[model samples]
Target: MNYFSHNPLNRFSEIRPDTAKMGELWRHEQARVLVVSNNLSLLQAEAREAAFLQQQEAVALANQAEVRVYLGSEGEVPYFALGFAGLPPALLPEAYELHDLRQVALQLPQEQSALLAYARGMVHWNLRHLYCPDCGSLTYSTAAGHVRQCSSEACNKHHFPRTDTAIIVLISEGDACLLGRQKVWQPGMYAVIAGFLEPGETLEQAVAREAEEETGVSLQSIAYHSSQPWPFPSSIMVGFQAVAVNRELQVNYDEMEDARWFTREQIVAGLQNGTLRMPPQFSISFRLIRDWFNQTGAYKLEELVSA
Candidate 1:
């Protein structure tokens, strides 16, 4: 129930969207231009409407570009501009940096982050899946940029945008939640156990499986905490609270570097002054942990700090 305000990284504005895109002719006309980040951060404002109208100017400013629409909530919310690219990995980083599209949402101002993230993720999916996997021929976008269908009649394949489900679980005992640090993580910091959802596994099952696999710590009664639509390419991180069934600590070195339990006292210090530090406030993981403390009524920080 504890929600964060416009805490910069914490903002993921809910823009109730309705996608009316349909038919082949309409898809042909809808812009396939690449949207840039430079425009929204600099020129955008609450009262400013002119910046949203200047679609041509934005295209002209780009070094190399294509024509795409800025899919916004109303007529001109300017969520994120679209770009037309066949293969994103081949693009030059200096001239035009291509991304997974999910990470972009994390970097933006929170108010429009989720909206833009959703738009970009679905669009990116459409870009790559232009051909039917079954027939190896061109496919077209459908469902208002939400789907792709093969052009070949003999091998008609329909593809939908994917959102792989994963869970980030905070394994807690009396005063501690078991945390692990990945090889890629910063020093002195640890976080909840996480993993991808295997075939037919429930969110709770995924949490238990991931925690046991990563740290060899069994979890019981995992409860959903919160969910954030993470775009890193396309993932939905569902945060959870799981009771520690077994206390023995074991680390699966293949998945994690260090895994251990951190007491509430240490968590308090880390939340305030931080050690090697934890996940930034922009991430849903931080919010889950923050809410955990708030639920216990033992700790509460006034500022919805993202750092």
Candidate 2:
């Protein structure tokens, strides 16, 4: 069974790799476009589904777009994303609302939510990569927006979309699991320890390092659980669960405001009494916590629903 992992778009990598092939998809009459402007995605205010625009409306905006990516097809209909950086909010139509991807994910259907995340990530990449990093030269998008080619005659290179890998692990010792809260987060809200994976490090190594650095606890028995596409800009969250060697609370104040182990009973009481809140059901964090509770028989599925 699917457990709230939001990715749904069937990205046709083979077709998108050919620039000539993507040109035909763009001209197809049945093409559907997702318009993103000023870090917000466009959607119908009433129905809240992705308000796909036809070629006519899309072409009009495409004329002024910073970049456009071919996001593959759903059956016979083609899909594309048009990005407009710095577009004014006042220019948006009254019938359509410019909502952030986070809000759109919660409001839109599974497919639409996945599509919006793709659009947001591609647009952000395009905006930040107008110049080549290899050589100080201008770059142009190629391969149907899948790659960027350097314009410099002396130094030519290709750049592709980037997704940073991060590890989010729940550390457990016996019946209790460790959770940390950042100072900026709401009071009593805690989640798993997470950090970006450094070069030459495996997922398990990253998990161990992050756990010790943030919570000062060594972890063993590292096991992979699942992963989620977190498209705030672009990130892939690799989820894992591990057993802590010790249950000491030595939090790095610079990394997190507070850290502590919460027993299953305490966690349940926190939720029941409104003293703590887990990550929303839409995120992998929630699943990691819930999975632990279920596996340990800390709380029944029905108890979580009522709490």
Candidate 3:
């Protein structure tokens, strides 16, 4: 049920390498562009559109963009992404509203949210990698801006966008599931254990390690749940359901401020009352929790809160 999980449009990854065809599509009148500036996007409420600007609107902000990436196509219409690390206020049309990507992710339609996640990830990658990692030379955008190349004659290396893989798991032991809250999070907010994958470690290893490190709980029978594109700067959140091998709890202060196990009844009560705060409905964390709760026919937060 996460916002960025299912995308309707075809990525057309096969055609991204074709520079000539991409160029032609970019010049097409019906081509759509998503403009991302300073982690915000151009949103038009009237049209229920998410940052997806027309070609003319995109061209108007050409001076503000550092790079434009071809973000594949939907049928015959092409989609492009414009990256703006520093966007000028004047360039933003009064007709459109500027909203943070996080807010957009929750408020926008699922299809639009998915598209924005993809575009924002590509934009962030283009903005951060302006130089070659190998040669220390200025890089130029190529392959419809999907690939960047080193300008140096001695060492011309091609670079592509990268996604960091992170594992988030709901660790359960019989009737209760473990949840942790970071110090920086809201007062009552809690989420499942999550951490980036270390080199030479499998997803199962990551789930076991993160669980133990954060809550001092060992996990058994790790199973994949679902994955979501969390473009909070290009991250693929891999969700999993893992059963805790032990009942003992050891909270790691460095990783989490608080860690505890909540029973299904407690979670339901928390949702009914205001004692707990869940992640946004559009997040994989929410989906993981909801999916786990659904087995017991427990009422969801939306039902409790909306009532």
Candidate numbers sorted by lDDT from highest down:
3, 2, 1
* Residue lDDT tens for model 1, 1-307: 2112232221123321234332221233232233433222222333121122233444343334332333433332233344455323333222334343333434544544544454455555665677788889998754445557789988878887788888888788887778788788667767778889999888787888788788888866778777777655678888888898777887899888988887767766766775646676667776766666666655563342343
User: In candidate 1, how many clashes are counted?
Assistant: 12
Q: What is the TM-score of each candidate against the true structure?
A: 0.71, 0.92, 0.95
Extract clashing residue pairs from model 2: none
**lDDT of candidate model 3 versus the reference:** 0.83
Number of colliding residue pairs in model 3: 0
> Which candidate leads the pack in lDDT?
3
lDDT of all predictions: 0.57, 0.81, 0.83
Which 10 successive residues of model 1 have the least lDDT summed? 2-11
Model 2 per-residue lDDT tens digits across residues 1-307: 1122555556788777776778888989999888888678888885478878887677767877888988878888888988888765544545776787674465668767777878888888888899999997999988778888899988889999899999998889998989889998878888888999999999999999999899899976899989988768778899999999989777899999988999889888888888887765667777788788888664663366455
Model 3 spans with C-alpha error above 4 angstroms: 46-48
Model 2 TM-score is 0.92
Error of 3 at 213 (Å): 0.9
